[model samples]
Target: TNTTKELTYSEAMYLCGYLNGAKKENRDLTITEREIRRRRSAVLKRVQRIGIDTTDWGAVNAFFLDVRIAGKKFRELDGEELLLLIPKLESILKKKEDGGY
Candidate 1:
């Protein structure tokens, strides 16, 4: 059986944050939990990069937790999770560039 899993909005946002942080920090494909928390600011940068204004950090934080990416807070995700998230983030960025966002 072939089943496709769809990511929720919060999950997508979390992945976007991770991707932006990784790119900004020039780090390896996988990062530690401490790094993820430290790099939460990257999420705002990424949203701005996509031409979206982020004046609501509270909402962003809530969304991150709602998605359960790092449980209660941004933390280290497994390498396997990062691998899956990277492609999704790339796709979102491409879509934004294509004016699909």
Candidate 2:
């Protein structure tokens, strides 16, 4: 019956082409996203060690918005945004430890 119907040659070729391209998507993105999250977590942990209340969501959001070039929320940040934010956070951390903040 219907289940036994064979795909036409062009239909089969199209499906194969779609699968070949789709299968390779997200592999690089997933790795980059994981690395970004890891670096973000490490920066936050260092902030916590300096006595900033990382638990308070509003303050965290405010800090991110203030320091971020794009003013994006924490979760909305991608690698490019995070790359820009990390250096600023690290600078503040260093200044705090040096009694500058």
Candidate 3:
């Protein structure tokens, strides 16, 4: 059975708004965002595998503060900010491995 039901005016408007919002959201993310997310994910995975204590607020805050990242929270960082953060995170991880934490 392939019966079709036409949408009401309000339903149509709601659908349109939902679709437009989705499109706008996708359009808002440029290539830089994608790249930054990719890099950030990789860095986080590596850090986790290396057993860095990401849950340690003091350490994480110190790292972000030292690197001059405006936000103390990693999830709040934007794409360009993540780009700057990844290398600093790696360096911090390296220092930790070398008993510098």
Candidate 4:
């Protein structure tokens, strides 16, 4: 339950660079950091709305959070980490739900 794989700092930097490039390469498009953050917030809210009862939902949401921050071109993510992390997230969510630490 403790072996959740997270993106390394280098990987995260690479992803952010790619995202910046993508935004700049758009000829007829404009994007802002505010827009990205707003989208990320929306995704976070949707994940919470899944009710925290199912392991799968928690796993999906955690992965989704990584995706949001990593700028969506994360080729290294294999989705298997979600299978490993769901139980831990479930417990955390349960504690948060029940007013426990």
Listed in order, each prediction's TM-score against the native is 0.34, 0.60, 0.46, 0.27
User: Which candidate leads the pack in TM-score?
Assistant: 2
Q: Model 3 over residues 1-101: C-alpha lDDT tens digits?
A: 23225777776776776877745555566555678779778756655655656777566546455545445566666677766766776786788889996
Better-scoring candidate (TM-score), 1 or 4: 1
Query: What lDDT would candidate 3 get against the real structure?
Result: 0.64
- The 10-residue segment with the lowest total lDDT in model 1: 68-77
Clashing pairs in 4: none
Residue 50 displacement in candidate 4 (angstroms): 8.8
Candidate 4 ranges with C-alpha deviation above 4 Å: 1-76
Best by lDDT: 2
Top-down TM-score ranking: 2, 3, 1, 4
For candidate 2, report its TM-score.
Answer: 0.60
- List, residue by residue over 1-101, the lDDT tens digit for candidate 2: 14325878776766676776734355577777789988778767765766768999776677667643347567777767666666776787788889998
Badly placed stretches (over 4 Å) of model 2 are 1-22, 67-70
Weakest lDDT window of 10 consecutive positions for candidate 2: 1-10
Minimal lDDT window, size 10, model 3? 61-70
The sequence of per-residue lDDT tens digits that candidate 1 reaches over residues 54-97 is: 56655544534555333432334444444444445556678888
